[model samples]
Target: MNGNESAPRDAAPRVVVGVDGSPSSGAALRWAVQQAGLIGGAVDAVSAWEPPVAYGWNAPVVDTSLDEENARRLFTDELREVLGEECPVQVHPRLVLGNPAAVLLDAAVGAELLVVGSRGRGGFARALLGSVSQQCALHATCPVVIVRAE
Candidate 1:
């Protein structure tokens, strides 16, 4: 190794995973970590939230701070539960505000891969793919992996 030629600082790849505090999302988080381990990459766990549309113009004003805090806590708890104490890969939690699919897609703009889970609606065709997962699969800049609950 020549002194003039420095090692690539950004050689390690990045994988983004969407977590929505659902069982399937937990599985997806695990899957993303496993894949990151294999590829020598890091994982970014992203969760999104937005103001409820049902709040009418004349309706009582609601504070979104509480909701954001709860979303952050949920995201942290899910990450901790999924990764446990001996996690091998580096995982970063990202909380954003907006549509889930759009947020995930934006987060994964330059990622090596993006992972998400099916919402797992039972006894129906919608069980196959959730809207977010479907949109990500169709529009993500990088490869998208969809994990389904066993």
Candidate 2:
């Protein structure tokens, strides 16, 4: 299917949201949860992380497997904390390794909507869309929503 194509009308749609433990991402997660409740669907909170690469005459001497694991645990725990037990909908937390934009776009396949925060650590202007948000908006298989922190 094309990137902009919506899901089939008869299917039970899923909502995917990117969360990074930031305030903005937290807002996005909350928004996505509400939207899922309204639509009678479940929410998938995705967190993506990639190890830093060292550039030099080195043979990739850096190991980030443990770091990635810790980050995944932390992100999942934070998401669960933010989405308290009183939340009205089901939330599934996922942690993956890759570029954030690519990961979200891939997850958007067969989803009803892709949600992300407006601004992130990247050097994007706060007044406008951040890089990851813009990328997902442009490339997601379904409609994309950008939630900005209040």
Candidate 3:
């Protein structure tokens, strides 16, 4: 198969999709699932969360585990809502603490395709493309698919 193709039929492909618990991200997850099914591949649903930045020299410590738990829940709930039980394609949920683009790029290693929403739940929803999506498109090792909310 060509390098540009999403996956080859002989091998089990992995499609990594970014999830942010947003409508557009939901659409991207659904699209990734469909693509995985078509290619006989698996879906990796990923979400990234980070603690709020502190400016003082002696900054107050925040409970980052809560953010991690929320990220995990977001990934799982999004997958369940999109595919429900007995999904045709296998879905793997992953939550990490880092920038969205960096997390997605790391997840895309050896992945056949990387999928993400054009814009996430961020303030710039009206923008054509979110920073994460744009960065992944430019730097991902594999082909990237930006799913737009309809």
lDDT of all the models against the reference?
A: 0.82, 0.82, 0.84
* RMSD in Å for all candidates: 6.5, 4.1, 5.0
* Top-lDDT candidate index: 3
What lDDT tens digits, residue by residue, belong to model 1 across residues 110-133?
789999998732235645788889
Model 3, span 102-133: residue lDDT tens = 98998888888999998888856467888889
Q: Where is the poorest 10-residue window by lDDT in model 2?
A: 1-10
Candidate 1, superposed: residue stretches over 4 Å from native: 1-11, 57-62, 120-126
Model 3 ranges with Cα > 4 A deviation:
1-11, 54-57
TM-scores, each model vs. reference? 0.84, 0.85, 0.85
- Collision pairs in model 2: none
Candidate 1 versus the native: TM-score? 0.84
Query: Where in model 2 is the C-alpha error above 4 Å?
Result: 1-11, 124-127
lDDT of 2 by residue, 49-69 (tens): 888877768576557888788
lDDT of 2 at 98: 85
